[model samples]
Target: MKPVYVIANNIISPLGDTTEKNFSLLRQGVSSVRLHEAGNRSPIPFYASLFPETFWQHHHTTFTKFEYLLAQSVNKVLEQASVNPAHPKTGLILSSTKGNISLLEENAITPQLKAEISFTQSAKKIAKHFGFINTPVVISHACISGLVALITAKRMLEAGLYENVVVAGADIITRFILSGFQSFQAVSDAPCKPFDANRNGINLGEAAAAIVLSVHKPLNDAPILLAGGAVSNDANHISGPSRTGQELFFAISNAMQEGAVSAADIGFVSLHGTATVYNDDMESKAITLAELQQVPVNSIKGYYGHTLGAAGLLETVISICSLQENIMIPTKGYSTPGTAQQMNVCTVLQPIEQEACLKTASGFGGCNAAIVLKKQ
Candidate 1:
């Protein structure tokens, strides 16, 4: 299989706009998470990373908030990477769990708005906005959608289906999502504390991220390779993950094997540490099972909350910043290791000496996915 390099990336998150800008803020331990008022999106106030309601008012657009974020992310990445969206060898992939689901709040959903609710239609509009030549592929496999999109792009590149792929993911928290999590009793009252003993639940956040993957070497940053990726299902529960984390371990093992790397070679691990009790514990078991107990692990959920479909991609983008800078961002709000299996969770910004890193995610339906990145 051919090697796929992350040529250019953009993250339009609450932290910052560009990758470098976000990384700079992260290095200083700055976070965007804050207490947001209930407004029309929830019955109660919640702690989450959100742009102000009027953040986009200056930029009038016909696109919905979700599509606007996606377009902004893509436009920046394309401009930075100089990738031709209209190239026949280039493909576009959009991933999200709830695209335009917020339209339900309207008094009456118009036919046009109803049509825009479909993921494919949203992708079509985003593609047309950028003059993309191919029908964009959509991945909505829960929270792992972003990583799954990257994996899919890698496969497409290796199969010679595309020379370059723009993998973008965007998800905005809405009343539907907030109520569902609250119904599950999973919404945290405070800033999420991943892997912390006092951790309670998760904070929902929204973000959009885009990364350009290509067969050619990048002209700018360190040559980061999306070397290996694997996805798995534990069939444990519809919402709960594998009790033993064996399924996630399988994905980690398979990913490393395919990447031609081993646990000993990894520098740090970007986690799906949603700050939820079970999630932190399950990931601990999975990492230990894979014999990565010593690898420094961190999560950005404390910075951006759980970004849902965009979580995987958003975290990956930030972690890529970590790899580029040879520094690891701490798992914000984690003051203790609360998982049953024990994990080496980073509590502060630390220097990193290695180049290979692993990123993992587990979502609803007992699904788990992992991918390895190597800097050459």
Candidate 2:
């Protein structure tokens, strides 16, 4: 397979608008999650990370919040990449679990806007806005949507279908999403603490992240190579992950095998630590099963909360920066080991040279995905 490199990337989160700014905030141990007052639907205070009110002032448009995020992220990458958006050889992939789902609210309902509630329709609107010649590919695979989108982009590039692929993932915090998680009792009243002994539950967050992948090298610096990726299903339960970590372990092993790397070669692991009881446990067991227990691992959820569809890509971009800078940021809100397995969870900033890293994510519906990133 031909090498696919990450040529450019952008992140629109509460921490900042660009990748540099976000990484700086992360290194400072700053967190964007905060307590939010109950709105019309929610009756109790909840914790979440949300965009500042002034964030949309400059990019005002008729598009919904979700669309605005996607457009802004894509626009940022387009500004840095040399690919032409309208070129036939350039492809666009949008990843989101709920695109413009907020429009389903009673106040947002209107005859003309009704059709926009469809995820496909919302994606097409963004694609058309950017003048993309080909139909945009949409990935709505729950939380792993972003990683799956990247894996799909790699396959497309390897198949000679596109010279450049723009992958963007975004999800806004909505009352609908909040209520659903609340009903599941999966939301935490306090800011989430991943892999902490007293860790409670996940705190929802909103963000949009985009990355440009291509066979051509980047203009600024050497590109990070997407070496391998694999996805698996535990089929344990619709909403619950596998009680045993075997399925996720299979994904990790396959990803490493396809990348032509071994467990010992991975310098760090970007964990899918949602802070939920089952997720953190399952990931710890999976890491140990893969014989990567000693590798430094950290979860970015402490910094940005869980960005849903954007989480995977957002973390991947941050990992890429970590590889470029050779500094691994600490996993915020973790002070003690919380899992049964003794995996190395980064608690403080560590500086070291890293050649390759593993990024893994497990979402609802028993879906798990892993990808290997190698510094070029």
Candidate 3:
């Protein structure tokens, strides 16, 4: 298989827009969550950790939310990678669970807005923003969408479909999302405390992230190799998490097998610790079944809140920076352990030197994905 290298990465998250400031603050274990705007929440009293709307206004050349985020993140990653998309050999992959959903809502209510925000229109706008003559393939796989995009990009690169692949994932927190999560009782009034005994559900947030993959040698960032990854379906429940963790175990095992690594070789596990009781328990079971219970695990939700579809990309970007800097941020708000399971969840922030990290994420559609990354 052709090696898929993460040549460059960038994130626009609740903590900060640039990777540098965010990484420093993350290392310090500081959280950016604040009470949500008065009218923006449900009875659950949602919290929002967001970059200023004004901060992205200048970058958002289009009125569509997804296009704006996709363009902004893509621009930053491309600039850092020094990859000129003006070349024809580059391919773009856009990922989001709710692509243009906000716009669709508005358009449905206001026909005049319909002309601006269709899904295809949003994808086209992003492609045009990067000056790419080729249309980009858009993937919407719920919360695991970003990781799936990265996996897809790697496959395409290995197949010689493109020399350089621009993979981007972005999503905005909207009233629709707030109400939906609230309907499921998944929104927490307090800042989320992943893996904590008294932990509530997730705190929704918005973020956009972009990652560049290339077959050629990367510059100096010590780009993590996208060694291998796998996606699996639980098929156990529609909304409830699988207690057996059968699907998650399959995903972890497949990823390990593809990368030719054992569970013991994984330095750390970037868990899908969403803090929900069932989710946390299921994840713990999965880790044990994979025989990776001893691996240190942490989640970034405490810092950025949960960015839903954008979480995988945002977390992967953070993981890459942590690998480069050699520090691991704590799973903020985790005071007491919640999972009555085997794995030792790394609650407190700790610094460590490691060469590989396995990032995992699961989402609404019974979808679970795991990606193993080796330090460059």
* lDDT, residue 56, model 2: 74
lDDT of 3 by residue, 1-376 (tens): 9888988888887667788877888878788888866664444456877667676657544456667777778889888888878678799888887766666445455665664655566778778867886678888887889899999998999998889999888888777777888889887888888888898798877888889999987766576799889999888777777878889989988988887788767778888788788888889889889888888888888888778768888899888876777777778888787785767777666665568888998988689999988875
Overall lDDT per candidate, in order of appearance:
0.90, 0.90, 0.81
lDDT of 1 by residue, 1-376 (tens): 8989999888988887788888888888888999988787887898988877776785555788889989889999999888898999999999999988988776487887778788988899899989999999999999999999999999999999999999999998888889999999998999999999999999988889999999999876578899999999989899998889999999999999988899889999999998888888999999999999999999999888888888888889887888888899988899966798888999888988887999999999999999999897
Error of 1 at 71 (Å): 0.3
> How good is model 1 by TM-score?
0.98
In candidate 2, where is summed lDDT lowest over 10 consecutive residues?
A: 105-114
Candidate achieving the largest TM-score:
1
Q: Against the true structure, what is each candidate's TM-score?
A: 0.98, 0.97, 0.94
lDDT of 2 by residue, 1-376 (tens): 8999999999989989999999999989899998888786478999889987788786665678888899999999999896798998999999998888787774666777778787778778888898999999999999999999999999999999999999999999888998999999999878888998889899989999999999987665656899999999999999999888999999999999999898778889999999999999999999989999999999999888899999999999999999888899899889878886888999998975668999999999999999999977
What candidate 2 gets wrong by more than 4 Å, as runs, is 59-61, 107-114, 219-221
TM value for model 3: 0.94
Clash total of candidate 3: 0
> What lDDT score goes with residue 171 in model 1?
90
lDDT (0-100) at residue 128 of candidate 1?
Answer: 92
The TM-score of predicted model 2 comes to 0.97
Model 2 Cα shift for residue 198 (angstroms): 0.7
